[model samples]
Target: MSQSRSRVIKVHANDNVAIVVEQGGLAEGTTLDDGLVLTGAIPQGHKVALTDIRVDDPIVRYGEVIGTAVVAISRGEHVDETKVRLPQAPTLSDLPLAIRPVPEVEALEGYTFEGFRNPDGSVGTKNVLGITTSVQCVAGTVDYVVQRIKRELLPRYPNVDDVVGLNHTYGCGVAINAPAAIVPIRTLKNIALNPNFGDEVMVIGLGCEKLQPSTLLDDRPVKIYENTEAADPDANVLSLQDESFQGFGEMVEGIMAMAERHLERLNRRQRETCPASELVVGMQCGGSDAFSGVTANPAVGFATDLIVRAGGSVMFSEVTEVRDAIHLLTPRAVDESVGKALIREMEWYDRYLEQGQADRSANPSPGNKRGGLSNVVEKALGSVIKSGNSPIVDVIGPGERVRKRGLTFAATPASDFVCGTLQAAAGMNLQVFTTGRGTPYGLPMIPVIKVSTNSTLGQRWHDIIDLDAGRIASGEATIEDIGWELFHMILDVASGRKQVAADKLGIHNDLVLFNPAPIT
Candidate 1:
């Protein structure tokens, strides 16, 4: 293809660089539509300088400075990480707060989905029997029982979608009373209450662990149900280390009995039509690339706006991912308190990273660089696009259940598993994850809708990717088109009318707790 016809995506007219969009990138001597000649071969997704830049000159994209040029670069030269120096993160102080009026948009109405409504008024996308464990010692027992429940007992409860062991590495050999311990404790507690489990709480304990059953359920809002009455909190708990259990077989039998009771309750529950306001959707992006901002993330952002207009709750997280772009976000907060809360989370994470002797530059992994992101600054700009233009109504610390509707910033590590786990704990019934590179990440407690940023990854991982926003990059579809399509797919998936690629393949990642507390 001639260079003039070859595509390059320039995010902003002021940007001095644009990413090569051709599948194999462009060769040296190729000319762009604007008659700019490539100085060297540029890889797809990699940046090509649109203007000659002097050393220390700002490297702009997305209408913001992502970095500074470390060496003089001619126009059309490939702008890789080696040629750029990372910029300082935005200061947490003196930021804009609610300065711009939130644009008035037509309210989206009449959208509904069939979901299982819990007694606490939460909606569930899946009816699962979540077997919780107080300590890692009971994981094996829980896992074994989960298989038995699925094979021997689940068949009896046709309404139960799946049996999942809420397995994790916390609850033992740790500083349970530490200040930071609340993160993991509340995370596990809230995850058990995740609407998907149908409010049936059962616990398996090892009898000796730092995080005890009562402690785990302390002050919990929902009660474990036994028929019409509240069950003895202890009645639902099975300790494998209990003197009454003589052996592993007896232990397994004990768990199965408790599970059957919960399954019976869950099996009787049926899907009911719930208004869009009942939907709690989490927005996240991983395996990102330049196209992430250009396509999938932008499309997800549009869908996020739609969900907000429909009166639903949406959460967008990844603390480090938002740190650099926080200046842009703070002004969008609905009030001063919410904006400060955003700064607080950022400050906390900054100290956390400093204590560990690291900084934000550690992000944008090798794969990220290979995908054309020069540094965390550039990556953050793209990552925040998933939030769209919604005014941030609230901000919660890691593992805290969301308290407000519309868009809330749920602070979390950028790790895919940890973020998904925290979002689930925050009561997200469904997650919309966008990716430029591919990932098979999914959660057992909720439905995850995977969106591919580029058609290349979408086509290669066709079965694993639920939707392709790449059509936006190819001009085959607009962001609003994919946004509406995704919005509809979400309702379908929530109602069980459709299954996400990961769920269809039974692919799920383990729940990784965010435990900043020290080990014993």
Candidate 2:
């Protein structure tokens, strides 16, 4: 391992590239290993040329090509917007897929967590029953319904647990089914299929929308609540009888009576030994510092590998950041074609950025920049440590669940709330998030175990964060030790132990959807 310097770096060993850790401060012509030297003072986290190369030559990092050289390059020059290029991925069947010899480790015996196993064979990490709407127009009605249910029912029905609101934007304005609306579509899937939900949800709908409640049922059973009811002329009843139409008091009473019976039934189910294959771990990182890749990311990567060995899966998003870290992922590609498909996703999104659908600046937010990331490429290079070099199983749009196991998958659309929220909806029992700065966010039905990259953020915002990885950078702890600790914590939480931070602060992010979607 190389010692940390104040500025200037090349991340990969084989690469003909280097990064300007501290931008614009070089005394020109300073020498580095392999005859590399400063062409000029490059910006921090920006790359510098290592050797002369022609256009389309691969620029390697983490020992894989993130992109090809856009233009002819010379030795010891800055390699970024001016020099580096993005590449396209090939078809999935053509991609590489490898079945490595599974590691021989004793399975943790009787690793049962107290949770609900839905009829569809899904395990829920939390005991939450919620009313989720398809669009924003219906959000208020669901909110109203929750308020009514809580005020009237929770007071007496102890087993009913928590009544949550799962509503968001993105059912409309799509190309009829682009991966854009898939996130919410799957969210609806899990909520209905999840055993944690009561016998029947008081389904709410606007009656006349593209995404109707009935369509979501497909084969699932549900108790529909229509906001657009017809008139009852004989009895002189009002036309609309949705919970929204009823007085808040009456609505709550009705829901309470219905919930009392089901809550008890749900409680009778107990935890059992299910293989880790039953688990879907959602991986994320934010508020990062330089220590992210070295400490927290690699640490989670270990847990990721452990889960995969147990026959489970891991999910990573924010594709832009994944681009910079693509090197670590290439070998995981099942084959060369899979590797090509993975890179293609990166290239397509890069072109999308040029059209302004997304902004690269958003990659390293103002908060991230303050945390020591100067730009998106720098932040991206560090953000993807959690995937842990597993094979690229498949590519999914937002809100889609992981049907394939043994490695990571690329999910479209990015935003912590939406991404994390969708992961839970897609059926992750728990989510593991690492932050160098801090974030107080948890998906509904999944207990988030927040790990801070640094101790300062952990201590300062202890109320929201659950663990501290700061020691990784401080040289006080190793990833193996921290990863073991994290696995234990995950077990505890799965067994119904509340991550203190989430318990204390009451943080829950629900119904966050994105892309080509209506406000509702």
Candidate 3:
């Protein structure tokens, strides 16, 4: 069959089974040499009987077990749900962390992107004016705050990107000490520290919350205002223009005047040469399928390697899909401590699920199964392909800043929507999202380039997706070729290209509001 499509050979080394990469016409009588003969039509990337397998015998692939046969499988026969099953692999924590393979290649020249260079040495994609919401008690206030400038003020001034409202779940119900509150607080801190920030931050809040805007932003310079004195109280926040409609107009004019100064300054900045390390790229996947691991994920993985080797930072989370490939990553651990930390995180989440809370088995949504994935472990093994083989540098939780470059980190709050949006807030200037299905998610300030696994979804969701890696699955392209395309695309999107989806639907979709989980 296709050499590039497959690596398995039927040389009779007793590897247990031969994996089918491309399934076209079998003609029923086709054979795999010797006594093996085709029994039925086969699916690409599925396994075939290379030798006689007993009903209870385990089927093997890549020198490791895949699943057991539900019935006696003869040589050259097809393997599907009635035959093979899924295997449970131990988390990397089960073994001592090992050293990563030495990199044998040269790094890229070092292609760099043009970005907004922050005073802190962090590069930003968009110059944004951040609006902070203190608590769930004032979530509506945050939205209303943006409408004031976006609808009323910015109609005349197009220079400023719309104000971003940060709303979340835990700021109201949970105590400050609970895990739920801790996570959101961490998320808030990350947003405040977002590299995309402009020279000024305007904070508005209701006075009665446990978390205060001024207290959270202790060190950062910002303008503070309260929402208690509005005419409508609930609908309209009390501003410097609160005395009367005429007086309020004057106050609004004053605030706008002050904001104009910051907008002028923001407009003056330009993209300059910056190290790839300064460009933090978040790798995300949603609506995945069989083509995902073989094509889009690995293609993104290759692009990920290119970026990482060039001194850039990449983070791939979504832990449920990383189960089967934990061993592959163990060899990439930079040190024993990093290895330990990676595994520790897995076990911690496992315990959290086992304690009668969220269950890991609940992963691999129905859409995943309908698309060919049977379970979470099967899904994770393929999922690990998104991160090419690179040294594990470090890990961070949700709302936490990714401090180390060339390191893979974990963020809590695994919802794809929340995770992808937070990546920008955590300082990622760009994000490469791979999907076997399709998603329309994007960020307020950050640009998201959607990479599809198959041509079907690519052609369907072309409006929102930026790059198409589906060529890999169609056998019309290779991972390296698609990887290069995606790499250059990151630069293009950064250089001021309006992606199809972002251009059509309007980008900058983010909301931090999470319902507060009660303290346990």
Q: lDDT winner among the candidates?
A: 1
Off by over 4 Å in 1: 1-4, 220-234
Q: Report RMSD for candidate 1.
A: 2.7
The lowest-lDDT stretch of 10 consecutive residues in candidate 1 is: 222-231
What is the C-alpha lDDT profile of model 2 across 300-413, one tens digit per residue?
987887777667767777776776556556656766655666767776677667777766555666666555454555566677768775556766655565667766564655
Q: Distance (Å) between predicted and true CA of 10, model 3?
A: 12
lDDT values of the candidates? 0.89, 0.61, 0.65
| lDDT of the structure predicted as candidate 1 | 0.89
Per-residue lDDT over 206-291 for candidate 3, one digit per residue giving the tens place of the 0 to 100 score:
55666666655666554433322332211212234233325444545434444444555566667677766677888988888656
Which of 2 and 3 is ahead in TM-score?
3
lDDT of 3 at 206: 53
Instruction: Arrange candidates by TM-score, descending.
Output: 1, 3, 2
- What total of clashing residue pairs does each candidate reach? 0, 25, 14
Record all residue pairs in model 1 with backbone atoms less than 3 Å apart, i.e. clashing.
none
> What TM-score would every model get versus the actual structure?
0.97, 0.74, 0.83
Tally clashing residue pairs in candidate 2: 25
lDDT of candidate 3?
0.65
